[model samples]
Target: MFTARRLSMVAAITAFALMAGCASQNPYDPNTQAPAEGGVSKTAKYGALGALAGAVAGAAIDHNNRGKGALIGAAAVGAAAAGYGYYADKQEAELRRQMEGTGVQVERQGDDIKLIMPGNITFATDSANIAPSFYTPLNNLANSFKQFNQNSIEIIGYTDSTGSRQHNMDLSQRRAQSVATYLTSQGVDGGRVSTRGMGPDQPVASNGTADGRAQNRRVEVNLRALPGAQGATSTVQ
Candidate 1:
């Protein structure tokens, strides 16, 4: 009788362990391979945590009321963050495709892509206006960028040391604005574009030789998806 009772208890314990294992299944385990859609897995995790925290906080604040409102708010915040992350991923992919095959060098810096352009394709010497021949290329770029729904573009103009500091600064600002205008005209949303002139502040090459100066007098186009822009706390290094 004693042996039979011990066996029954052991069997019950084993069943309970199996049930617990089944109940605790983690859907978002990283070891489980993700789907081919390239979704933002991290965002989903963050969103779940955010929602849980929100619900708890909400419930704590309103002890008289049930935790329903808190749970809803938390879920909303999580969903919003996840949605933004997905949008950012899509924009990044589209930008990569559009800039590919073009002569421009595209570098992925965090959540933004930087297009480094030499002076030859962007502007003429001591000129703030873009050359007429560059219109087609610029237009193509703008059109390609239109695929991104929530991204911002920044045009940064630079110059060599051939002129006064103030003069260089002014020229650089105008040049940056010119590029921004061209982009806006080519279907890119005007509100999503910004311009800055670095003058001789950030040079890619030495300013001692003609070639280096030419390289220095260039424009850089920086494109960042909205989520990245929002999360970015510091200037580009």
Candidate 2:
């Protein structure tokens, strides 16, 4: 009787161990650390961690091939970040090339890029309508944006201090909308574009001199990649 009881207790313990093993076999939690294959930076590391977490969650929700799914998701996220960094660098270089001597200032703040255009190119005096000559440059820009399909474009118009504040504001808003419309017509996704007018509120140059007025009466185009489309690269212009 004693030996039989001992044997029964051993069997119970074995069964419990097996059950625990099966219960703990979580495919999504591979505990696999991302290997530093290359010179990965802190930004890349954080991005990878976030991607891994997202992948694990997604795989768990799917309830199918969770381990494989998580791995693939993490890898994709890492690759995308690396690709975006490379693409952004290339784009900055290309922008410098195209904007050289154009008198337009290009600035990148965080993920946003700004292109400032002189008013003479965008509109005629006191007119909200964009100039015919301006279409070429704008078209070229639109073409460049086609490659970066996931980015949004914002057009902002401004005017000199020649007109009433209200009038200038209205004209500027119209001008901005016009540019947005033109970009949409040029094959840019309308959903990814917006427009606004600053009137004379934001002036990069003085409104006193002819040249300064010309500069003040201008438009600005801001570009930023939409969420989930980061690291994707395109050659539009």
Candidate 3:
């Protein structure tokens, strides 16, 4: 007769095997720059881990009815894990759809989403004003931000190492502020938005060449879910 402890151990091992064996089926690879086309979602991975832990706990606690306890435990914990990532996952997917072909890149890093906007499309040379052509895209972004109100937005501006450090710093600050202001004007909650200036630091590419300098001069918008807003949803469409 298999003991309750042994049964639980077997369950854990099986789940682990499934998780590992299905690696190729996992959609979100933190190492890659692009989203996978077809695979198990990251939320499922978390649920699997949760189920494993829950099964062990449930079996250990309910000696009289270990199997039933394990089932209930796995269901509860797995559901919680799946729900935890739902908000961000949905938001990321929507943002990707929203930003398609707009020259902005939507990247998922853990639970956070980042939007990278190149300098040429965002701003004019040495100017804090936003380019006229970018307004529509900014409007679209503001709409999405308004829909995903649970997130705190941070806009960071970067400049090429072409000018004095202090000057670049100020320019970056102004550029970031400009974006923030525009978003707020579009009815995005100003309270959730903040801006910073990196001042020619954290270059995405070498500044020695014109192409690299162009790439380096840009802005990044990072969205992180507020602690209290986990699993929260908005009615905005």
Candidate 4:
């Protein structure tokens, strides 16, 4: 949950940032670079890269069994969040169809799937509570995940470059935990789910524009393969 004092401060910072109209860049992405190519949002690219980086970091910490998603650490960086190429193509197709026009993007990265939920649809400014708009799409995804129990999910939360680093990071962390809690309540196994807060480190859009900031503040769920997914969907369309 977001505290009132923190929210007030973040809201103040956000209001000022919006009025100024320039996005600040943390240590990861500099303000100078343009939007990423292939029309892929920097959020997804950076997230995937972050997930990969996380994997490497985890592997460093636990060299014996790096395949575990929990070992990715709290940061959840890197593209190799987990080994890919296990989910079925038809399942991905179904997920794509379900997410169509829902403002929830379904992106297939090799054997993994990334469902990107932008802030406008997930949460209001400076808050971590799940918004009503988030339910419909998540319910739809939850249904799919219930059937695909063999898959492990990594939920990463991000924010725009409006507030202080610590505040933004804390907000992002709470948001991720909220989403994870809701999903578990919806029947997605809590054990297979991991949450990480990337803060304003991975912006999909420029923090400069209101629309860009809206897109940058998001939660991305990456579905990865599990080794013993006996009845799991593994076909690629």
Candidate 5:
């Protein structure tokens, strides 16, 4: 007989496989939301896949009563979905508490969490090096990230339109990588993290004025939960 833990692992793996096969684009990418073929949300589609996987796992696990095993497997997956939501909520609350008074602003959007960190606090002008003062907050963030280890992290760096586009892009990439390096050095899983540089793009404010330019040169960290709370988080390595 298969253990419940083994069944859950199988279900998660199967659901992810189904999602990856069905969508040409990445379903778990934070930058894009791929449309479903029949108006079904990705979550719903994956939920159904998980159910199917559970049914299959349950049947295989229970030799004498396959039907009963299938039902139990599906129920277990449903429960895991609910559990994921609960943990997500707790993680958001903990992040908000930890980031309070730290120059970082935590914003929750749907199932995703965004952290905006101003450039002045994160680095010196035209430099990719992290400011010494910012280390404490980054450390705190690393602790929270380790505690809530199921979410994939995306660190995006941006810059004002001051220098050549190529220069800005390289600087931005270095800045993003700097943050990623610090987090991983603090024991956060490196495999769960990715970084991108969007130089002089998607500015939150106008670049004409000093204040607007200040706002434009900043970094954003986005956290997106992976499927199945019981499964370890994995993303681009």
Candidate 6:
């Protein structure tokens, strides 16, 4: 008898086939709807097929992890943190434009931008190595950071709570380190970048389901303001 993991793997393969069929009949849509009055209009910057394909670590898409959706269009910059906000906004716009149709989402969180890379595509089956297919996306991201050349970069790695703590945590650390290494290799300042591994911690979805597990195994790149620099691009390492 096939285990749940095996069953989920089969299901994922099916989803890919179905997705291809769907794409053949229709273009990938972000499925954006008009914003409510005085509210942000949610726009999914990533392509539908890619996102579906990426998240299906071997199961259907987990809607619960997608969040309320991304805020579309340029957000108004406030007076208090106008400089940081504007900088972040421009970076966000550039990232979204660059990563369009890549199944990678660029979202705004207050004064920062969160680049969410689905783990299914990012790493392969408990491996810390970044998949070849994922390199282009990371390269594009590195280029964007180079262009912006400001703010601190924090790469956080996550994993589903399946394996032992030591093993999972080690895997997470290596994954985060791998991303940081890639960015610095692309000429992003090393000192401005840091890596953290949060294995099985702060899960965005339940671990009971395969879809949720796939969603939980993710890497988040957070761009934040440099301490005391007040959003200035300080050359560090």
lDDT (0 to 1) per candidate: 0.63, 0.65, 0.76, 0.66, 0.73, 0.64
* Candidate 3 lDDT tens digits, 1-237: 457677856487547633642443233434444433245555656667767767667766777887777767776665555443556676776777777777888888767889999887898889999998678779999999887788899999999999899999999999999999999999999999999999899999999998888788899999997777653333433
lDDT per residue for candidate 4 within 127-199, as digits (tens), equals: 9989999988889988888876667899999999998999999999999999999889999888999999999
Give the lDDT of residue 78 in candidate 4: 25
lDDT of 6 at 156: 93
For residue 185, what is the lDDT in candidate 6? Answer: 96
lDDT of 3 at 87: 63
Candidates sorted by TM-score, best first: 3, 5, 6, 2, 4, 1
Off by over 4 Å in 5: 1-78, 227-237
Question: Candidate 5: lDDT of 36?
Answer: 39
Give a tens-digit lDDT track for model 6, residues 1-237: 334764555445435433433333211123522222223211111122333334343122333432111111011111121344345545666777788877677776655678888777788879999998789999998898888767889999999999898888999999999999998999988989999999999998999998898888889999887765342322322
Model 4 vs. true fold: TM: 0.61
Cα lDDT for residue 102, candidate 4: 83
Overall local distance difference test of candidate 6: 0.64
> Which 10 residues in a row give candidate 4 its minimum summed lDDT?
21-30
Candidate 5, poorest ten consecutive residues by summed lDDT: 24-33
lDDT of 3: 0.76
User: TM-scores across all candidates?
Assistant: 0.60, 0.63, 0.79, 0.61, 0.65, 0.64
Candidate 3 lDDT score at position 100: 72
RMSD of candidate 2 to the truth, in angstroms, is: 13.6
| Runs with alpha carbons beyond 4 Å of true place in candidate 2 | 1-78, 231-237
* Sequence-dependent TM-score of model 2: 0.63
Q: Pick the candidate with the highest lDDT.
A: 3
